[model samples]
Target: MKELYFRAMDAIHNACLFVAGAFLVIIVLIIPYGVFTRYVLNSAASWPEPLAILLMIVISFLSAVVCYREYLHIGVGVLPAFLHKPAKSFLGWILEMLMVATNLFMFIWGIKLCQTTWHQAIPEFPIITVGLAYLPIPIGGGLTVLFVIERFLTQKFFSEPEPETISQLTTE
Candidate 1:
């Protein structure tokens, strides 16, 4: 059952990586193109600016979920470093609970925030509603909740794997 959940969440992790990478590529290409058009062509294109902003928001939020899962998110470790194994484990649990609370806050309010802006259409792009751009908040928050649950069950952060574990995993 745990393996099944890990497999599922691994798929989500990969999908997030792909989406964030794609958005980054698009941003890199479009921003330069936008600059080129503005300066060389003497035509300021509005599409690229807003489009980049939208992609950035998606990338940022989605990438945040990935970061949290990987334990890439910034945290305080100095105190934990000094603690014994039991104390460290307790601190880890406390921090994990706090993260779940924060994720839940984002998840609940994010839906309301998204809905409130649903009617407002982006002036630059009529086809896409403003609400659509805000979707990453809830998405990321929900994913975080799942990851926290996984951590609880596994008794691990699933963050950085130790070198020995990595070697063992590869061998197995």
Candidate 2:
């Protein structure tokens, strides 16, 4: 089960990285093209603005999944450090539960939002529907929830150590 979970996570991580890399490359190329066209050619790249926005959305969602998978999200550290082990564990559980709830909420709402926008096409990119554009939210949120659950299960059943803190990692 753990292996399966890790495999799935690895696949998702690689896929997201690839998508993010492509999106970034597109953005980089488009910006230079837009600049050159406007300055030298005296005309704008017709698709650059909309395409850049779309790429921004994709990059944000993919990077968010990467961050979640890596356990790099921002959080308060003082409370965890000051608490006893049991207290810290309990607090961590509560935090994870809250995160699960938030992810579930985003997943449900994101799907609904996408469904409602399914028929609507983006103004500049008419080839794709808004549903497709917005689909990443639910997908990324679902992945995040999965990773969180995996972490919870591993800690609960396997006694994995809590993630290290900055203070713990640095020597005085």
Candidate 3:
């Protein structure tokens, strides 16, 4: 059961990471295109600026989830490095629990934020709702919770999981 859950969460986490990476690439290409069209062609481009901002939101939140999962999120490693294994693991649990709390806040308030703006449309793209732009907040938060839960179930919250083999690293 735990293995199944791990696989499921890993799949979701990978999908979000891929989507965020795609958003980054899209913004890189599209923003330059927008600038060229507006300045060189003297065209009034309506979509690029707003689209870039939207993609940025997705990238910001989704990358955070990935970073936390991979043990790459910023922290004061100096202190933890000196501690015994039990103490280090205890501290890690505390920090992760705090993160879970923050995620919960985001999940709750983000939905409210989305609801508040759901009916409002963006000036750049009339069809896109303000809520749609805000979707990443809660989705990211919720996905983070899923990942944290998985970490706990897999014993990763208390201790570092085994280092991955080459294929394991690339497949995800």
- Which one wins on lDDT? 1
- Each model's RMSD to truth, in Å? 4.3, 5.0, 3.2
Clashing pairs in 3: none
What is the lDDT, from 0 to 100, of the residue 98 in candidate 2? 89
Ten residues in sequence with the least summed lDDT for candidate 1: 163-172
Cα error of candidate 2 at position 123, Å: 1.4
> Per-residue error at 166 for model 3, in Å?
9.9
Per-residue CA lDDT of candidate 1, range 91-143, in tens? 88999999899999999999999999988999999988888888889888999
- List the candidate numbers ranked by TM-score, top first: 1, 3, 2
Between the candidate structures 1 and 2, which one is better when assessed by lDDT? 1
lDDT of 2 by residue, 71-128 (tens): 5566677777788888888888998888899989889999999999999988888998
Per-model TM values vs. the true structure = 0.88, 0.86, 0.87
Evaluated against the true structure, the overall lDDT of model 3 is 0.82
Q: Against the unseen true structure, what C-alpha lDDT does each candidate score?
A: 0.83, 0.79, 0.82
In candidate 2, residue 10 scores what lDDT? 74
Model 2 residue 27 CA deviation in Å = 0.8
- How many collisions per candidate? 0, 0, 0
